[model samples]
Each structure stands twice: as structure tokens, then as C-alpha cells.
Target: MAPNLSQAIERIDAAHSEDPTKVDIDGEPTPYELIYAKKMSKFLELHTPNPDPLLATAARAQHFRRWEVPRDSYPRTKPGYFAWRTFLKKRQADQVRQLCLDCNYSEAEADKVAALVAKEDLKKGEGKGDADAQIIEDVACLVFLDDQFDEFEKGHDEEKIIGILQKTWVKMGKRGQDLALQMDLSDRAKELVGKALAG
Candidate 1:
């Protein structure tokens, strides 16, 4: 990685390290967002042959300070959910953009990372965005599926789990789907994914 990109990722990790939520990682209590950021970077590395620096930075900062914007802060209704998500995308993008600038990245480069974080380059449906944007989306979906799906499904009804899996499946391209199939998911998760696909 270039020096600026390395510095950018370091800065993002520093921000992630402040998340108050903790998760057990190999018996060590680690900040949840820091683990999440690392997972994003790992998934992106697997999905893309050679990931761009801006895209890598965007991946690392995808959920930057996400705990500060709790979902419960908004109403539980669908419109409220959309509003919250929209706000988060904009807020994360703007903050990460400024961080990139602080790392000496050019305005255009920083803006590209912000756009990736905001998902502005995506169109509705799979394979409908620019390569970089689509890869970023894929990386995110991959991380969620690989790292969060097991626990996430435990909290929802089967119908809800299947519904969420279906929605997540559509967001991925062929490469992502292929990688997902190869993941070492638990048997239950595989069954849920099968049901989601069959539905």
C-alpha cells in the first residue's frame, strides 16, 4: 500500500478503536467496530484482485463511529428506518472524506472514497454499479454474511431471516455470490441461505 493509503487506514482504525461496544475475539475483549473494520478490509481483499486505495479506505471506514448513530434513535417505522440509514451514509461519508483529506489525499480521491461509503455509485440490482462501487458493496455484504449472519439470524424469526438473506443476496454480484457459497458457514446458515434462494 502507498504511504498515504496506509496512513489513511491507520487513521480509520484509530477512530474505530474508540467504539464502546466490545466483542470477544480469541478471548480478548476487542472494540466491535475495530473488528468490523478489519473484516471489511479482509473481505475486500478476497473479493478484489487488487483493491484501490480509496476503496480500501472506504471499506475500513464503512461503519466509522457507527455506534454513535444507534438505530433506536429513529422511529421503528419503515420511513424512519430509511431516514436513519440515509443519514448514516451521509455522515459516515462526510467524516471519512475529511479524514482522507487530512491524510493528504487529493479532493477527488477523497470524494471517491466518500461516494463509495455513501454508495452513490450503485444502481438498483446486482452488477449495476461501477466496478469499484460494486466491489465495495460486495465486500460489505460478504463481511455481514460471513461474520454477523449466525448471531443475526438467532434474533429474528425464520421468515425474517430468510427475507433478510434474500435482500442481501440480490446486492451481490456473481463473484461475491461465488465467494459466499465457499464460506465455512454453519449448517443452519447454509440451510437458511438455501431457503432464501429457493424462495
Candidate 2:
């Protein structure tokens, strides 16, 4: 990694260190969003060993300071969920854009990073799916499936779980879908996923 990119990632992690929520990763107590960002980068690396600098930066800062936007700030219903997600996407993208600029990235590179962070033109961009956008989607979907699915499933109903799974599946490429199927989900989660795929 370039020193500037490493510095950007480190600064992002430092901001996330303020989060109170913690999770154990391989027996180490890791801050929530910090670990999430790390997982996202790792998944992106696994998806494409030779990722562009902009794509890598976008992935590493996807959830930049996510804890600052508490989910409870919105309504508890689906509309609220959508609103929160939409707001967070913009916020994260903006934060990443500034971070990239601070890292000495050109405006073109910052714009590309922002677009990926916001997941722009995911399925329809370029009229045939943008490859970089798809890579961003695939990495995020894989990270959620591999690391966050269990906790996510615990709070949602089966119908909601299935709906989310279907949406996530659609965002993924064939490789990501294949990897998702091989994840070690609990039996209930697996059943819900199977039903979602079938439906």
C-alpha cells in the first residue's frame, strides 16, 4: 500500500476508535467499524488481488465513522431504515472524499472513490454494470455475509431476512454468490437464505 493510502486508512480507523461498541475478532477486542472497514478491505483484496488505489481507498473507508450516525436517529420502520442507509451512504462518501483529498489524491481519483463509496451505478452504470462498482458491491456483500449475517439475522424476522438476503444476492457477482453459499451460516439463516433464493 502507498504511504498516503496507509495514512488515510489509519486515520479512518483512528476516528472509528471512538466507537463504544466492541466485538471480538480472533480473540482481540476490536472497535466495531474499524473491524468492519478492515474486513471490507480484506474482502476487496480477496476479490481482486490487484485492485486500483481508488477502489481500495473506497473499500477501506466504506463505513468511515459510521457510529456517528446512530440508527435510532430514524424511525424504527422500513422507511426509517432506508433513510438511515441513504444518509449514511452520503455521509461516508463525503468523509472518504475528504480523506482522499487530504491524502494528496487528485480530484478525479477522489470522485471515483466517492462514487464507489456511495455505490453509484451498481447494476445499471455504463449500461452493462460498472466493473469497479460491481467489485465494491461484491466485496461489501461478501463482508456482510461472512462477518455480520448472524447478528443481523437475530433481530429481523424471517421475511425481512429473506428480503435482505435476496437484495444482497442481487448486488453480488457470481463469485460472491458462490462464496456466500459456502459461508458458515447458522441452520436458520441457511434455511432463510435457501427460501430467499428459491423465491
Candidate 3:
């Protein structure tokens, strides 16, 4: 990573460190958002090792200080869920953009990062803007499947789980789908994934 981007990532990481919500990682206490960001970054690296600095910044800061936006604060309806998600994407992009600008990156560079974080124009297989954005989405899906799906499965019913699996599968690329299928998921979860894909 470039020096400026390294500095900006430090800034973002520091902000996430302040989150009050905590999660245990191998018996170590870690801030929830920090772990999430790290997972996103790791997934991005595994998905594509040579991502540009802007994409890397977007991945590492995609959930910057995300605990500030508690899910319960929004209504429990579908529209409310969508609204909160949109708010998070925009907020994350804006925060990362400021960090990039503060670290002396050009406005265009920062804007590209913002666009990637917001996932403004992602497509299947174009270069740069479109493909980079899709990679980020693929990383997110991979992280969710690997890290959060068990917890998420607790609240939703079978039908809902199937729907979510389908939605997540659609967001991912071929590599991510293959990786997910190869995960050591519980039998039930694997069955649901298989069902979703079989459809």
C-alpha cells in the first residue's frame, strides 16, 4: 500500500477501535467494527491480491464506525432495512473520502474510493470502477457467509434464509460462489445453500 493510504487506513482503524460493541475473536476482546473491517479487507485480498489503493481503502473502511448506526434504530420493515443499508453505504463512503483527502490523495482518487464504497456503478466484468465495485460486493458476500451467517441464521426462518442466500449468491462472482460452496457450513446451512443454487 502507498504511504498516504496506509496513513488513512490507520485513521479509519482508530475510529473503529472506539466502538463500544465488542466481539470475541479467539478469546480476545476486539471492537466489533474493527473485526468486520478486517474481515472485509481479508476477503478482498483473498478475492483479488492486486486491488488498487482506492479499492483497498474502500474495503477496509466499508463499515467504518458502523456500530453508530444500530439496526434497531430503524423500523423492522423491509423498507426500513433498505434505508438503513443505504445510509450505511453513504456514510462509509463519505468517511473514507475525507480520510483520503486528509491523507493528501487527489480529489479524483478520493471520489473513486467513495464511488467504490458506495458501490455506485458495479457491473459484472468491466475494469476498474465496475469490476472493482463488484469485487467488493463479492468480498462482502464471502465474509458474511464465512463469519456472520450462523448468527444471521438464528433469527430468520428457512424461507427467509433461502431468500437471503439467493440474494447473496447473486452479488458474488464465480470465485466467491465456489469458495462459499466449499465452506464448512453446518449440514442444514449447506443444504439451504444447495437448495438455493439448485433453484
Candidate 4:
């Protein structure tokens, strides 16, 4: 990594280290968002050959100060869920944009990283879109599936889980889908994914 990129990632990790939520990692209590940010970087590195510095930074900062906006703050309805997600995307992007600028990235570069963090112009269906943005989306989806899906599935009903899986499948590009297929998910998660793909 370039010096600037390494410094930016360190700054992002410093922010993540403050997350109040803790999870066990190898018998040590670790900050949840810190773990998530690391997973995002690892997935992007593993998937994107010679990943862009901006994309790597965006991935590292994807959930920048996420715990500040708790999900339960919004209503449990679908519209509320969408609103919360929309608000979070903007908030995180804005925060990371400023962070990038503080790290000495040019304004254009910071804006690009913010746009990638916001997932602007991702390839939703078949039409062409920004390759870097798509790669960021793929990394995020891969991280969620690999790290969060099991606990996430336990909370939601089977129908909801399958629906989320299907939507997740649609958001991913081909590379993400193939990578997801290869993940070593538990039997129940595999079953849910199979049912989702079948539909």
C-alpha cells in the first residue's frame, strides 16, 4: 500500500476501534466495526486484482462510525429500513470524504472515494457501471455473507432470510455471485442460499 493509503487505512481503523459493540475474536474482545472493516479490506484484496487505492479506502471506511446510527432508531417497517439505509450511506460517505481530505487526498480523489462508498453507479442488473464501485459492492456483499449471515439468519424468518439473500444476489456482479457460491457457509445458510437461487 502507498504511504497515504496506509495512513488512511490506519485512520479508518482508529475510528472503527471506538465502536461500542464487541464481539469475540480468538478469545479476545474486539470492536465489531473494526472486525467488519478488516473483512472488507481482505475481501476486496482477495477479489479485485490490483485494487484501486480509493476503492480500498472506501471499503475500509464503508461503515465509518456506523454505530452512531443504530438500526433500531428507525421503525421496523420496510420503508423505515430503506430510509435508514439511505441515510446511513450518505452519512458514512460524507464522513469518509472528509477523512480522505484530512489524509491529504485531493478533493477529486476524496469525492471519488465517497461516491464509491455510497455505491454510486453500481451494476444492478446488466447495464454497464463503474467497475470500482461494483468491486466495492462485491466486497461488502461477500463480507456480509461470510461473516454476518449466520447470525442475521437466526434473527429473521426463513422467508425474510431468503428474500434478503435473493436481493443480495441481485446486487452482486458475476464475480461476487461466484465468490459467494464458493464460501464455506454452514448447512443452514447453504440451504437458504439454494432456496433463494432457486426462486
Candidate 5:
């Protein structure tokens, strides 16, 4: 017989009960910690057609880490900040790419997955101002390039796409620099100012 919802929930609870590390202000263990501890069991229980546990876990961890690192502590200089974000983004993209591969996605589909990652607004609905908007736009442009490259590979219109991408890159570069200047960056990050200015 198929398991009932209560039975499934009980199993999840039991798996979590086996280990408890991190906790919230009220002393409740975080779901992520629980998921990490009981990944295998939880994977089996929560198996669905749409989502995979491993991918979900990786994404969740990335999201958690992003917020955990205080923005003030981030690299202040332009190059430093760019390098830091580049490193973080590459790691995140690698994980997503692996997930796509495991899910049997084609190369084109995998590229789309990477593009989506670059375009995603990690800080959506946060009520921030123009700086946030600029970051989002710049990141989206990066994603757009990835997608455009994929289109080029498929023999689609190239000249028009290149022109559009060039224009977008110029606009995003300017906006990124403006946003970067408004914040206090580290000396290392400052080096990225020139690159951002030229972008």
C-alpha cells in the first residue's frame, strides 16, 4: 500500500530527530541542517517528478551562504568584489550544471540552465534601490550573452544578436560602475573599478 501523508511526515520527522546541529533563535533546528543530515532518507521520501533533492540542497546551501556573509565584510575594491562574486557565481553555476547533467539535459539545455543561474535575481523583493536594480540588470546581461552564444551555435542570426549584446554590455558596464561607486569597497575590490568602468 502507498504511504499516507502522516506516515511520510513521521518519517521526515524521525530522520531529522537523528541529528540536530544548527538552530534558530527559538532553538529550532534549521530545515537545511536536517536535510543535510538525512539527505539519503529525505531524498527517498521526498522524491518527486519535478525536483531533485541534491539540486535543491545545493541551491539552498548557496542561498544560505550568500546571506550569511555580511555585505559589509565583502571585498570593497572593484576587482576584489568582482573576483569574489565571480568565484561565488562559478561555484553556484558548476553545481547547477552538474545537476543538469545528472538529469540528462542536452548541452543546449544545460547552457540554458547556466544562463538562468546568471540571470536569476538572488535578492528579489528585498525593497532595495537603484543599486540592486543595476546589479540585477548586469547579471541578466551576462545570462543573455550565454543564451545568445547558444543561439549562435545553432546557426541563428548572428550580426543582429552581436549588436544587441554589445549595446547591452556597454549599458550594464556603466550601471555596474555607478552602483559600485556608491558603496565602500576594499582596496582589492577597487582594482575592478577600471574593468567595470570599461564594461
Candidate 6:
């Protein structure tokens, strides 16, 4: 079973104790600060210098914030969701690319990683499936996109990036359509699509 909030908090507290000065709460020690500090420390220890501390923190916060929000509260409008997802994807891709480069991966290898990360398999099957598999796929795709984007910037073909994005959008959009087709979602989905098309 997964650890509850209390257990997770305790673990974070213990990790924070290793670097008391890093912990902060309203300018003093706080649980949030402790967790951040420990996370940064662990990241630095395990990974080479590529994913900047600030970037990693920002990406992590953005990713988790989405998870924290109730599913029902997710933005249903096309433009709204599109913009939000774009922001997240860009950040995730950038971070993963940096990590791949730092690890001495070649440009081709990195692009492959980014393509894998940008995949939209999560939009399938009522959004229900193997949790671990989904997580692995997400990470892989993100890393692939990150690497690919980096390569594109360094004189690689822009068309390749565009093609990848186009294909990914189609796949993701199809899944969205599938989700919208569910008996329970037809009305809301139609409304969202109408709004999206109008916008």
C-alpha cells in the first residue's frame, strides 16, 4: 500500500533534518521547504549538472499541482486545456532533454527520448489502465521529446519536430474524442468541442 500523508510527511521531515538550513517556513523551518531541499539535494546527488535546480522545482510543482486538483475541476475548454498542457509539456520536455544531454546521450538518442515522452497513451480507455505502465510511458515520452527538441535547436530539421508534434496531437485528440464519446460525457464533451472550435 502507498504511504499516507502523515507517513510521507515524516519521511520528508527525516530527510530535511540532514540539511536544517535548507528547510524554511515563512522564513523559518516548514515542511514544504524541507521537502524541497531534500528533493534538490537528492537530485543533485544522483544526476549530473544539467537539469537546473530551479527548472526541476518548477516542473515538479506544476506537475504535482495538476494532480492535486480534483479531476472534475480540470479545465474542460479546448483552449484552456491546450494552453495548460502545452506549458506543462514544454517544461517537461526541456527538463528531460537537459538530463539526457548531461548524461552524454547523443543528439539522435535524445530526440528519440523526446518523441517517446510526447506520446498520449493516457487519453485511452476511460483514462484507466496500469498505473505503473502509464507512468513509465509518460517518463519515456517526456525524455524523448526533451532530447529531440534539443537536437532540433542545434541545426536539426525543424520539419521533423513539426511532424512529431502533429502526429502526437492527432493521437491525443483521438483519445480525447474517445473520452468525450462515453455516454456520460457526450453533452459536456460536445460543449467543450464547440467552444474549442469556435475559439
- Give candidates' CA RMSD values in order: 1.8, 2.5, 2.6, 1.8, 17.2, 16.7
Error of 1 at 197 (Å): 1.2
Candidate 4 — which pairs collide?
none
Tell me, by lDDT, which candidate is best.
Answer: 4
Name the lDDT value of residue 84 in candidate 6.
68
lDDT by residue for model 3 over 27-143, one digit each (tens)?
A: 998998898889888878878887778888889887777788999889999999999999998998898888899998888989989998888887644434477788888888888
RMSD of 4: 1.8
Per-candidate TM-scores read: 0.95, 0.88, 0.90, 0.94, 0.31, 0.28
Q: Rank the candidates by TM-score, best first.
A: 1, 4, 3, 2, 5, 6
lDDT of each: 0.89, 0.84, 0.85, 0.91, 0.42, 0.40
lDDT of 4 by residue, 128-169 (tens): 899888889889999999999999898989999999999989
Q: Could you tell me the C-alpha RMSD of candidate 5 in Å? A: 17.2
Q: Number of the top candidate by TM-score?
A: 1
Candidate 1 local lDDT, 1-199, one digit each (tens)? 2329988988899999999999998999999999999999889889885687887888899988888999999999999999999999999999999999988888899899999999887856534567788888888999998889999989999999999999998888889999999999999999999999999
Candidate 2 residue lDDT tens string, 95-142: 888888888888888888898999887876226667888898898988
For every model shown, the clashing-pair count is 0, 0, 0, 0, 11, 14
Off by over 4 Å in 2: 1-3, 26-28, 125-127
- Please give the range of 10 consecutive residues that has the lowest summed lDDT in model 3: 122-131
Off by over 4 Å in 6: 1-78, 112-123, 126-133, 137-199
- Distance from true location, Cα of 121 in model 3, Å: 0.7
Backbone clash pairs in model 1 (N, Cα, C under 3 Å; residues 3+ apart or in different chains), count:
0
Off by over 4 Å in 4: 1-3
Q: Candidate 2, 159: how far from true, in Å?
A: 2.9
Q: How close is candidate 6 to the true structure, as a TM-score?
A: 0.28
Q: On a 0 to 1 TM-score scale, where does candidate 4 land against the true structure?
A: 0.94
Q: Which scores better on lDDT, 3 or 6? A: 3
